[model samples]
Target: MHGPHVVVVMGVAGTGKTTVGPLVAEALGVPYAEGDAFHPPRNIAKMTAGHPLDDEDRWPWLDAIGRWAHERAGYGGVVSCSALKRAYRDRLRAAAPGVVFLHLTGDRELIGERMSQRKGHFMPETLLDSQFATLQPLAEDERGVAVDVSGSPHEIAERAVAALRAA
Candidate 1:
């Protein structure tokens, strides 16, 4: 919040990263990018077929998002990414230093319910467990904040903005 920085809105599937990311970007007066758009066709096909992506399948997608974040460095931007592992976040940070994270978190039942209600998303609800299993919460050394996903997208985005400001 002190200066322009790229913020990665991160979380497991159905935690509303996509829904809340744009609102956070709007509140911060920055451009927003959908992390899913960086995914290659094969990745989408695998996920649509109900398969969880391995590290190999994710590196390229993460790199693509990282490139965009690097381009937005110091200019401010927000992007939604299911950065489910510490290694993935580290990789992104390596590509775009000073990148901050906004982690969206919620209980499994709530997230599963949200996934069930969603339509046309390639990530199936069946993959939710794998997503949770892979998630690595932000560490103390990380420049980030975790916001609970327990309300409307706007409310969650407001919380994200406040948390980022405080961070």
Candidate 2:
């Protein structure tokens, strides 16, 4: 059986997954999984140079992230991923049958602005549009909660924890 709940903090590049995932993990008493660490260098370079990753470039990374999510399900953990598309989310589900996603959503332009101001990130602001195009918002059947990114980081983190606790 899966542990209490595994929060997968998911969104586009600047949607606060990195910022929020650990906060939620701390609140829930679980380890934090950095999904970006699982990405291949090639993909990282492609995004670093302002090129968007296609489906082929993403599948294996998705698989790795999913496995990472499932690997510690016995104890519970939080994973941050740019799980933009439904197929990506599907692979995550296959790896961990009961993973719960906390989607951090915001306007593409706003996110791009954040990405531009950010430092040390490989994913450039130019790829923000592609990420938005690829996104498939959580469906009603998915075990997830949608948190708007228009608020403060703590607000978003609290909202995710509240949803998980309530669930």
The prediction achieving the highest TM-score against the true structure is: 1
Error of 2 at 119 (Å): 0.7
Show the colliding residue pairs in model 2: none
Q: Over the stretch 47-137, how does candidate 2's per-residue lDDT look in tens digits?
A: 8888998889989998998887778777788999988888889888999887998989898777887888899988877778788888889
How well does candidate 2 score on lDDT at residue 57?
Answer: 93
Model 1, 1-167: lDDT tens per residue?
Answer: 67899999999999999899999999999999999999999999999999999999999999999999999998999999999899999999999998999999999999999999999999999999999999999999999999999999999999999999998
**Which ranges of candidate 1 are over 4 A from the true structure?**
none
Error of 2 at 64 (Å): 1.2
TM-score of candidate 1 against the unseen true structure: 0.99
How well does candidate 2 score on lDDT at residue 160? 82
The models' CA-based lDDT, in order, is: 0.96, 0.85
Predicted structure 2, TM vs. truth: 0.94
